[model samples]
Target: MPVARVVVDVMLKPEILDPQGQAVSRALVRLGFDGISDVRQGKRFELEVEGPVDDDALGRIHKIAESFLANTVIEDFTVRVENGDAS
Candidate 1:
Protein backbone atom coordinates (compact mmCIF):
# COMPACT_ATOMS: atom_id res chain seq x y z
CA MET A 1 0.00 0.00 0.00
CA PRO A 2 1.03 3.55 -0.62
CA VAL A 3 0.77 6.54 1.67
CA ALA A 4 -2.00 9.03 2.22
CA ARG A 5 -1.24 12.65 2.96
CA VAL A 6 -3.62 14.68 5.04
CA VAL A 7 -3.75 18.18 6.35
CA VAL A 8 -5.84 19.43 9.23
CA ASP A 9 -6.47 23.01 10.16
CA VAL A 10 -8.23 24.06 13.32
CA MET A 11 -9.48 27.55 13.99
CA LEU A 12 -11.44 29.28 16.68
CA LYS A 13 -14.94 30.35 15.81
CA PRO A 14 -15.14 33.92 14.56
CA GLU A 15 -17.70 34.89 17.17
CA ILE A 16 -15.49 33.74 20.02
CA LEU A 17 -13.30 36.09 21.97
CA ASP A 18 -9.53 35.72 21.78
CA PRO A 19 -7.61 37.59 24.42
CA GLN A 20 -4.24 36.69 22.97
CA GLY A 21 -5.28 37.98 19.61
CA GLN A 22 -6.51 41.18 21.17
CA ALA A 23 -3.24 41.62 22.99
CA VAL A 24 -1.29 41.23 19.78
CA SER A 25 -3.51 43.75 18.04
CA ARG A 26 -2.97 46.26 20.83
CA ALA A 27 0.79 45.71 20.75
CA LEU A 28 0.78 46.28 17.02
CA VAL A 29 -1.09 49.52 17.46
CA ARG A 30 1.39 50.69 20.11
CA LEU A 31 4.22 49.83 17.75
CA GLY A 32 2.74 52.24 15.17
CA PHE A 33 1.14 49.60 13.01
CA ASP A 34 -2.12 51.23 12.08
CA GLY A 35 -5.39 49.71 10.94
CA ILE A 36 -4.55 46.29 12.20
CA SER A 37 -7.82 45.25 13.71
CA ASP A 38 -7.83 41.60 14.56
CA VAL A 39 -5.68 38.58 15.15
CA ARG A 40 -6.53 34.91 15.66
CA GLN A 41 -4.42 31.88 16.43
CA GLY A 42 -5.01 28.52 14.90
CA LYS A 43 -3.44 25.08 14.58
CA ARG A 44 -2.40 23.14 11.53
CA PHE A 45 -1.36 19.53 11.16
CA GLU A 46 0.20 17.65 8.27
CA LEU A 47 -0.05 13.89 8.39
CA GLU A 48 1.02 10.99 6.26
CA VAL A 49 -0.85 7.75 6.56
CA GLU A 50 -0.02 4.29 5.45
CA GLY A 51 -2.52 2.05 3.63
CA PRO A 52 -5.68 3.01 1.83
CA VAL A 53 -7.76 5.97 2.99
CA ASP A 54 -11.47 5.62 2.69
CA ASP A 55 -14.47 7.36 4.23
CA ASP A 56 -14.21 5.22 7.31
CA ALA A 57 -10.67 6.35 7.99
CA LEU A 58 -11.69 9.91 7.41
CA GLY A 59 -14.46 9.53 9.93
CA ARG A 60 -11.98 8.16 12.42
CA ILE A 61 -9.73 11.13 11.83
CA HIS A 62 -12.67 13.44 12.48
CA LYS A 63 -13.36 11.68 15.71
CA ILE A 64 -9.72 12.08 16.68
CA ALA A 65 -9.99 15.77 16.04
CA GLU A 66 -13.06 16.06 18.15
CA SER A 67 -11.79 13.90 20.97
CA PHE A 68 -8.17 14.94 21.17
CA LEU A 69 -6.87 17.37 18.59
CA ALA A 70 -9.47 20.11 18.94
CA ASN A 71 -11.71 21.62 21.53
CA THR A 72 -15.00 21.12 19.74
CA VAL A 73 -16.87 23.45 22.07
CA ILE A 74 -14.97 26.55 20.95
CA GLU A 75 -13.30 25.59 17.69
CA ASP A 76 -14.03 24.01 14.35
CA PHE A 77 -11.68 22.08 12.10
CA THR A 78 -11.34 21.18 8.44
CA VAL A 79 -9.54 18.12 7.17
CA ARG A 80 -8.22 17.66 3.68
CA VAL A 81 -6.76 14.61 2.06
CA GLU A 82 -4.04 16.02 -0.13
CA ASN A 83 -3.04 12.86 -1.90
CA GLY A 84 -4.78 9.51 -1.98
CA ASP A 85 -2.79 6.44 -2.76
CA ALA A 86 -3.84 2.85 -3.14
CA SER A 87 -1.03 0.62 -4.23
Candidate 2:
Protein backbone atom coordinates (compact mmCIF):
# COMPACT_ATOMS: atom_id res chain seq x y z
CA MET A 1 0.00 0.00 0.00
CA PRO A 2 1.03 3.60 -0.65
CA VAL A 3 0.85 6.49 1.78
CA ALA A 4 -0.97 9.71 1.02
CA ARG A 5 -1.13 13.09 2.66
CA VAL A 6 -4.28 15.11 2.50
CA VAL A 7 -4.83 18.77 3.17
CA VAL A 8 -8.29 20.07 3.57
CA ASP A 9 -9.63 23.57 3.95
CA VAL A 10 -13.08 24.10 5.36
CA MET A 11 -14.69 27.47 5.25
CA LEU A 12 -18.02 29.02 5.99
CA LYS A 13 -20.20 30.02 3.09
CA PRO A 14 -20.25 33.69 2.10
CA GLU A 15 -23.83 34.07 3.17
CA ILE A 16 -22.99 32.83 6.64
CA LEU A 17 -21.88 35.14 9.42
CA ASP A 18 -18.50 34.78 11.08
CA PRO A 19 -18.71 36.26 14.51
CA GLN A 20 -15.26 35.21 15.65
CA GLY A 21 -13.54 36.65 12.59
CA GLN A 22 -15.63 39.79 12.90
CA ALA A 23 -14.55 40.20 16.49
CA VAL A 24 -10.93 39.76 15.56
CA SER A 25 -11.18 42.39 12.85
CA ARG A 26 -12.87 44.77 15.22
CA ALA A 27 -10.11 44.25 17.72
CA LEU A 28 -7.56 44.92 15.05
CA VAL A 29 -9.27 48.18 14.24
CA ARG A 30 -9.34 49.13 17.89
CA LEU A 31 -5.61 48.45 17.99
CA GLY A 32 -5.11 51.16 15.31
CA PHE A 33 -5.23 49.06 12.17
CA ASP A 34 -7.26 50.88 9.56
CA GLY A 35 -8.82 50.16 6.17
CA ILE A 36 -9.80 46.62 7.15
CA SER A 37 -13.28 45.92 5.92
CA ASP A 38 -14.33 42.31 6.44
CA VAL A 39 -13.04 39.09 7.97
CA ARG A 40 -13.89 35.44 7.56
CA GLN A 41 -12.80 32.35 9.42
CA GLY A 42 -12.15 28.76 8.35
CA LYS A 43 -10.45 25.54 9.37
CA ARG A 44 -7.56 23.48 8.05
CA PHE A 45 -7.22 19.71 8.33
CA GLU A 46 -4.20 17.52 7.64
CA LEU A 47 -4.10 13.78 7.63
CA GLU A 48 -2.39 10.72 6.27
CA VAL A 49 -4.06 7.79 4.61
CA GLU A 50 -3.21 4.59 2.76
CA GLY A 51 -4.91 3.94 -0.53
CA PRO A 52 -4.65 3.73 -4.27
CA VAL A 53 -5.03 6.94 -6.27
CA ASP A 54 -8.44 6.77 -7.89
CA ASP A 55 -11.88 8.33 -8.04
CA ASP A 56 -13.21 5.96 -5.41
CA ALA A 57 -10.65 7.16 -2.94
CA LEU A 58 -11.52 10.73 -3.73
CA GLY A 59 -15.20 10.03 -3.26
CA ARG A 60 -14.49 8.30 0.05
CA ILE A 61 -12.56 11.34 1.18
CA HIS A 62 -15.43 13.57 0.26
CA LYS A 63 -17.74 11.32 2.22
CA ILE A 64 -15.44 11.71 5.19
CA ALA A 65 -15.69 15.45 4.78
CA GLU A 66 -19.47 15.32 4.60
CA SER A 67 -19.88 12.89 7.48
CA PHE A 68 -17.51 14.18 10.15
CA LEU A 69 -15.18 16.91 9.04
CA ALA A 70 -17.39 19.76 7.89
CA ASN A 71 -20.59 21.41 9.00
CA THR A 72 -22.55 21.11 5.78
CA VAL A 73 -25.22 23.56 6.85
CA ILE A 74 -22.98 26.61 6.77
CA GLU A 75 -19.65 25.54 5.35
CA ASP A 76 -17.94 23.97 2.34
CA PHE A 77 -14.72 22.03 2.05
CA THR A 78 -11.96 21.47 -0.48
CA VAL A 79 -9.47 18.63 -0.61
CA ARG A 80 -6.03 18.58 -2.16
CA VAL A 81 -2.96 16.41 -2.14
CA GLU A 82 0.53 17.73 -1.64
CA ASN A 83 2.75 17.48 -4.69
CA GLY A 84 5.16 14.97 -3.18
CA ASP A 85 2.58 12.55 -1.80
CA ALA A 86 3.84 9.70 -3.99
CA SER A 87 0.67 7.67 -3.63
Candidate 3:
Protein backbone atom coordinates (compact mmCIF):
# COMPACT_ATOMS: atom_id res chain seq x y z
CA MET A 1 0.00 0.00 0.00
CA PRO A 2 1.18 3.48 -0.79
CA VAL A 3 1.46 5.97 2.02
CA ALA A 4 0.89 9.69 2.03
CA ARG A 5 0.80 12.62 4.41
CA VAL A 6 -1.68 15.41 4.79
CA VAL A 7 -1.42 18.63 6.73
CA VAL A 8 -4.40 20.64 7.84
CA ASP A 9 -4.04 24.19 9.01
CA VAL A 10 -6.90 25.74 10.94
CA MET A 11 -7.26 29.43 11.62
CA LEU A 12 -9.85 31.76 13.08
CA LYS A 13 -11.90 34.01 10.85
CA PRO A 14 -10.67 37.54 10.39
CA GLU A 15 -13.57 38.97 12.36
CA ILE A 16 -12.96 36.71 15.36
CA LEU A 17 -10.98 37.96 18.31
CA ASP A 18 -7.96 35.87 19.38
CA PRO A 19 -6.89 36.78 22.88
CA GLN A 20 -4.06 34.28 22.90
CA GLY A 21 -2.61 35.77 19.76
CA GLN A 22 -2.86 39.26 21.19
CA ALA A 23 -1.13 38.19 24.38
CA VAL A 24 1.71 36.68 22.39
CA SER A 25 2.05 39.88 20.40
CA ARG A 26 2.21 41.94 23.57
CA ALA A 27 4.82 39.63 25.05
CA LEU A 28 6.89 39.96 21.93
CA VAL A 29 6.79 43.73 22.18
CA ARG A 30 7.87 43.56 25.79
CA LEU A 31 10.78 41.37 24.76
CA GLY A 32 12.00 44.14 22.41
CA PHE A 33 10.47 42.69 19.24
CA ASP A 34 9.25 46.11 18.17
CA GLY A 35 8.78 45.17 14.52
CA ILE A 36 5.90 42.89 15.41
CA SER A 37 2.48 44.25 14.67
CA ASP A 38 -0.20 41.61 15.13
CA VAL A 39 -0.46 37.91 15.79
CA ARG A 40 -2.96 35.17 15.11
CA GLN A 41 -2.89 31.69 16.60
CA GLY A 42 -3.76 28.64 14.56
CA LYS A 43 -3.50 24.86 14.58
CA ARG A 44 -1.83 22.24 12.44
CA PHE A 45 -2.80 18.61 12.02
CA GLU A 46 -0.65 16.03 10.28
CA LEU A 47 -2.22 12.82 9.09
CA GLU A 48 -0.37 9.79 7.83
CA VAL A 49 -2.52 7.82 5.46
CA GLU A 50 -1.74 4.16 5.02
CA GLY A 51 -3.29 3.76 1.58
CA PRO A 52 -3.14 5.51 -1.75
CA VAL A 53 -3.89 9.20 -1.61
CA ASP A 54 -5.83 10.60 -4.52
CA ASP A 55 -8.33 13.31 -5.28
CA ASP A 56 -11.09 11.34 -3.64
CA ALA A 57 -9.01 10.91 -0.52
CA LEU A 58 -8.18 14.59 -0.43
CA GLY A 59 -11.83 15.48 -0.78
CA ARG A 60 -12.69 13.22 2.11
CA ILE A 61 -9.95 14.78 4.19
CA HIS A 62 -11.30 18.21 3.45
CA LYS A 63 -14.71 17.16 4.61
CA ILE A 64 -13.21 15.70 7.76
CA ALA A 65 -11.42 18.95 8.44
CA GLU A 66 -14.60 20.91 7.99
CA SER A 67 -16.62 18.58 10.13
CA PHE A 68 -14.22 17.79 12.94
CA LEU A 69 -10.97 19.72 12.90
CA ALA A 70 -12.28 23.25 12.62
CA ASN A 71 -15.36 25.24 13.47
CA THR A 72 -16.80 26.19 10.10
CA VAL A 73 -18.75 29.07 11.64
CA ILE A 74 -15.67 30.92 12.88
CA GLU A 75 -12.64 29.16 11.43
CA ASP A 76 -11.28 28.24 8.00
CA PHE A 77 -8.87 25.49 7.05
CA THR A 78 -6.38 24.60 4.36
CA VAL A 79 -5.26 21.14 3.34
CA ARG A 80 -1.89 20.15 1.97
CA VAL A 81 -0.88 16.74 0.64
CA GLU A 82 2.70 15.64 0.72
CA ASN A 83 4.50 12.59 -0.53
CA GLY A 84 5.15 10.08 2.21
CA ASP A 85 8.91 10.24 1.85
CA ALA A 86 8.86 13.99 2.42
CA SER A 87 7.70 13.44 5.96
Candidate 4:
Protein backbone atom coordinates (compact mmCIF):
# COMPACT_ATOMS: atom_id res chain seq x y z
CA MET A 1 0.00 0.00 0.00
CA PRO A 2 1.07 3.57 -0.69
CA VAL A 3 -0.04 7.04 0.19
CA ALA A 4 -2.19 8.79 -2.33
CA ARG A 5 -2.96 12.47 -2.70
CA VAL A 6 -6.38 13.89 -3.27
CA VAL A 7 -7.30 17.37 -4.34
CA VAL A 8 -10.53 19.23 -3.74
CA ASP A 9 -11.19 22.43 -5.62
CA VAL A 10 -13.93 24.65 -4.28
CA MET A 11 -15.28 27.65 -6.07
CA LEU A 12 -18.20 30.00 -5.85
CA LYS A 13 -21.08 29.37 -8.17
CA PRO A 14 -21.01 31.45 -11.33
CA GLU A 15 -24.14 33.25 -10.30
CA ILE A 16 -22.56 34.27 -7.01
CA LEU A 17 -20.47 37.40 -6.77
CA ASP A 18 -16.82 37.02 -5.76
CA PRO A 19 -15.65 40.17 -4.06
CA GLN A 20 -12.19 38.81 -3.42
CA GLY A 21 -11.80 37.90 -7.03
CA GLN A 22 -12.90 41.35 -8.06
CA ALA A 23 -10.42 42.94 -5.72
CA VAL A 24 -7.67 40.79 -7.15
CA SER A 25 -8.63 41.75 -10.64
CA ARG A 26 -8.59 45.38 -9.72
CA ALA A 27 -5.20 45.02 -8.09
CA LEU A 28 -3.84 43.33 -11.18
CA VAL A 29 -4.96 46.22 -13.33
CA ARG A 30 -3.43 48.67 -10.92
CA LEU A 31 -0.21 46.71 -11.13
CA GLY A 32 -0.29 47.15 -14.91
CA PHE A 33 -1.54 43.67 -15.79
CA ASP A 34 -3.89 44.37 -18.65
CA GLY A 35 -5.83 42.38 -21.22
CA ILE A 36 -7.22 40.07 -18.52
CA SER A 37 -10.93 40.55 -18.45
CA ASP A 38 -11.97 38.62 -15.40
CA VAL A 39 -10.67 36.62 -12.49
CA ARG A 40 -12.21 34.27 -9.96
CA GLN A 41 -10.83 33.02 -6.69
CA GLY A 42 -11.22 29.51 -5.36
CA LYS A 43 -10.08 27.22 -2.55
CA ARG A 44 -8.03 24.09 -2.81
CA PHE A 45 -7.79 21.28 -0.26
CA GLU A 46 -5.26 18.49 -0.26
CA LEU A 47 -5.65 15.19 1.56
CA GLU A 48 -3.12 12.47 2.08
CA VAL A 49 -4.74 9.07 2.07
CA GLU A 50 -2.96 6.04 3.38
CA GLY A 51 -3.01 2.80 1.40
CA PRO A 52 -5.02 2.92 -1.78
CA VAL A 53 -7.72 5.44 -2.50
CA ASP A 54 -10.36 3.00 -3.51
CA ASP A 55 -13.96 3.60 -4.40
CA ASP A 56 -15.00 3.61 -0.77
CA ALA A 57 -12.39 6.18 0.15
CA LEU A 58 -13.37 8.34 -2.76
CA GLY A 59 -17.01 8.08 -1.78
CA ARG A 60 -16.21 9.06 1.80
CA ILE A 61 -14.18 11.99 0.55
CA HIS A 62 -17.03 13.12 -1.63
CA LYS A 63 -19.35 13.05 1.35
CA ILE A 64 -16.83 14.99 3.38
CA ALA A 65 -16.48 17.56 0.63
CA GLU A 66 -20.22 18.06 0.38
CA SER A 67 -20.88 17.96 4.09
CA PHE A 68 -17.98 19.86 5.64
CA LEU A 69 -15.75 21.37 3.01
CA ALA A 70 -18.10 23.30 0.77
CA ASN A 71 -21.11 25.52 1.33
CA THR A 72 -23.52 24.03 -1.17
CA VAL A 73 -25.73 27.08 -1.13
CA ILE A 74 -23.26 29.27 -3.01
CA GLU A 75 -20.34 27.06 -3.90
CA ASP A 76 -19.36 23.98 -5.91
CA PHE A 77 -16.56 21.45 -5.53
CA THR A 78 -14.74 18.74 -7.42
CA VAL A 79 -12.67 15.79 -6.19
CA ARG A 80 -9.59 14.36 -7.84
CA VAL A 81 -7.27 11.50 -6.85
CA GLU A 82 -3.61 11.77 -7.77
CA ASN A 83 -0.72 9.37 -7.45
CA GLY A 84 2.49 10.11 -5.50
CA ASP A 85 3.65 13.39 -4.03
CA ALA A 86 2.65 16.52 -5.87
CA SER A 87 5.97 18.21 -5.29
Candidate lDDT (C-alpha), each: 0.84, 0.85, 0.91, 0.93
Q: Model 2: clashing residue pairs?
A: none
Clashing pairs in 1: none
Q: Is candidate 1 or candidate 3 better by lDDT?
A: 3
Q: Which lDDT tens digits does candidate 3 get at residues 1-87?
A: 766789999999999999989999999999998988999999999988778778888999999999999999999999998654743
Task: Write the number of the candidate with greater lDDT, choosing between 2 and 4.
Answer: 4
Report the Cα RMSD per candidate: 4.3, 3.1, 1.7, 1.4
Ranking of all candidate structures by their lDDT, best first:
4, 3, 2, 1
Q: How accurate locally is residue 4 in candidate 3, as Cα lDDT from 0 to 100?
A: 79
Tens-place lDDT digits, model 4, residues 26-72:
99999999998999999999988887789999999999999999999
TM-score of each: 0.75, 0.81, 0.90, 0.92
Model 3, position 76: C-alpha lDDT score: 92
Candidate number of the best TM-score: 4
> Alpha-carbon error at 85 in model 3, in Å?
7.5
Sorted on TM-score, highest at the top, how do the candidates line up?
4, 3, 2, 1
Worst 10-residue lDDT window, candidate 3: 78-87
Least accurate stretch of 10 residues (summed lDDT) in model 1?
78-87
Say what the RMSD of model 3 is. Answer: 1.7
